[model samples]
Target: MKKTKILILSAMLVSTLFSCQKLVEIKETDLIAGDVALKTITNNEQGIIGAYAAMNVEMGILLNAVFADEVVTADFYNAATVHEWQYTSTDISIRDSYTAFNLYYRIIDRVNRVLAALPTATAANATDEAKRSRLRGEALFLRAFCHFELYRYYSNSAVGTDLAMAYMETPSLQPQARITVAPYFQKLKADLAAAKPLLPTDFSGTNVYRATQAAASALQARTALYLKEWNDAVTFSTEYINAVPLASRANFPGIWTDANSSETAFKLSRTASLGGRIGSLWRATSASASNIGGITWTISQKLWNMYDQANDIRFSSYAKDEPLLVGSGRKYTRLITKYAGTAYGTAAENVADAKVFRTAEMYLIRAEARAENNDLVGAAADLNALRAARINGYTPVVLASKDAAISAIMDERFKELAYEGHRFWDLKRRNLPVVRITADLPQVNAATTLPAGNFRFLLPIPNAEIQANPVIQQNPGYTN
Candidate 1:
């Protein structure tokens, strides 16, 4: 019996993942039997690296910015296509949607391959067996994390019946139907549960880049928030918080600068050499000698104003008033400097490690979960703690009601997670609209009000996948 080369999508790259570079395979088969390809502990460990390379969160970050009100196209040129919200029409903003869809599944496929090879792969000693087990856990974690990402982006809502992604465990070319939203998450939870014990409790050199017990818990905390499993959300977030406290005021800026990994639960290793920078998404590729970046996107003035510029540390940490000389004059535009690469302030290298999960987010999760659970005092404390760390001379406020606490938590999330990519989905999770600042509308040149439950919120399956698989269904409103 021959194995099916399960293409993650209609056309997917069979790229080599050593040293984090892509090399296309031109072979009759995209397979080497599991035992041969991953015959040893080293082989299995290295196989997981490919999954990490293919896991690109930057695509989702791009979608979160362009589709929602967090950003607007620069003054003259709209670098990317402005989104068209109608179900049947081509939307430029969401053009990256299919790319995101394709990427997550590609990650899943890479993970599954690692997993499929594990049982038969040789581990010569107890140390090797321990390492192998950890690899298996990390593979499972990646699968759960990627599936959760797809579920949030593609599902209309988290309701049980809403159509979500096909959760693939075993690799196969057989066509798969979309699973419902509920089971999708349940499967994700099961994978995480299986992954946790096999994973290490600590973060070491390269393991810091790989998923650990902390990272798995972070996923659980976040998933609980989405499912409104308030108690679990609070419990899991508190678990991460207890382990890694918030980065201090002095150290807070360093997290963005790649100066330190103070409260980082997990991050993707990106470098000038290995090259998976996220900065180019907001910055133009080429810039003249006089200017730093030909900034393609800027934080919406509305978002910019929300920052306490002088008082809030995030104001400087997330962006800068990038001064550019314009025709014998100087003008300052707010540039998203979050991904300013390893060169930091100078050189505009536009690359940096992608911080996938941080402890600060746990605080926010605890806050949101507490709010929804009507633990108003606890929610306020969590919210206040995060704000106090990020802001100078911070003053705490009481959230008189659960609604007010949730609202405040939303604002905190915006300020905390701006360019790091949570804005759009945060609103979508709450069934809230993408309410843009009136002035922000013309800057984007597209729908300013994306009401909750709109068809556009659910990204259509990439045409490649739809045309490739007979059993697949296009998302509810999108046409083939």
Candidate 2:
């Protein structure tokens, strides 16, 4: 492992949904030098906790909501860079192109630090040793998870020649070149596989906030689904689904409101004190009956029309429609309520826990994999199972062919996982064009269709990274 000459005053260790928060800080400058910060098992535990806090699933959701078809922005928002798809590799604004390069890499650096320190750290007894094992598992999973996220945006194509992400396992100040996706995924799977046995299966209460065996399986299922590893996708997703079944209709809305952890396999706690609320990512910033105009970025009319607003549980789980007084008449605007702040404490509006891994997604993953593997009946069963769970009176449907099953699964994912950051990637993975309805696009003056294989499909490598690391390669169709 390359030793890093680093200066981290506090947490470089924050993570996202399904991990922890708050890294252990030291009073002195050399917190990371010669294993000063993590010289004990307790220190290692705090370090890993800090790594988990660094991740924010909202990062992906916020970017995709604007760039993808789920949202339509008005001219008033002035988010042309991202909303209008005018982003360059060099545009570094918060609302510009979607790239969490520095953030994810920072997490990888902290996780690597924990891994390096875990070996020599003092363990007083077997209990401490057991804790060490769990810490190691969590650290490995986080490192792989960060790399996977980087690949999700950075890799245009996960091919041998296409530049993917620099799969980091060591901490260093030296610049590194991007590697091919094939090897990157290879190492990603290797890390998950290694950590699987070491992690615990009990993902109850606060345990779900950490990296559990179930969370690792969830990540595996998602990774395989993207890479077209049908059998593995089914295998890993099944593991997660078996551990955490789909939420019942009565419990569905509660998942988003943080009222209950029904089908949630992993979620990051979003304390109001942290001020990490993302409900305002859109124009309205917060959604409600009184603040109808607060629904700034109206939910895409096309996508909204697809939902059974009267019956389907998800229609209400994600958003609501309120009458808007426009001119003398009235018009209704859809408000995204998925991030509706918790009743536990409503001091903050639009603040909700990042439920990263829901069992509902596993069912979809298994369905997609089964369909791709030519198991139409199995795919239909999985699809219908999730539908039955979400909708009031869903009846099973027969898929005539593989294409039909895949199409159904894709649409199901669109509605089931809307605004959770899956829409754009699902379309991209399937090589399908992003087709937004005319009603949603015209109001925002946004493009109706982002053709498949467009350069914008892959976020450009950050210009800062490209400049600092001369060896790093930028994605094609971007400027330095």
Q: For residues 85-145, what per-residue lDDT tens digits would candidate 2 score against the true structure?
A: 6788777553243667878999999989999999899998899988998999999999888
TM-score of each: 0.88, 0.89
User: lDDT at 347 for candidate 1?
Assistant: 47
What tens-digit string does per-residue lDDT give for candidate 1 at 143-169? 999988888777736578878879999
- Model 2 — which ten-residue stretch has the worst lDDT? 1-10
Task: State each model's CA lDDT, in order.
Answer: 0.79, 0.80
Model 1: residues >4 Å from true position, as ranges? 1-31, 79-98, 285-289, 326-332, 342-348, 443-446
The TM-score of predicted model 1 comes to 0.88
lDDT of 1: 0.79
lDDT of 2 at 354: 89
Q: Model 2: runs farther than 4 Å from truth?
A: 1-34, 94-97, 156-158, 283-293, 323-332, 342-346, 442-445
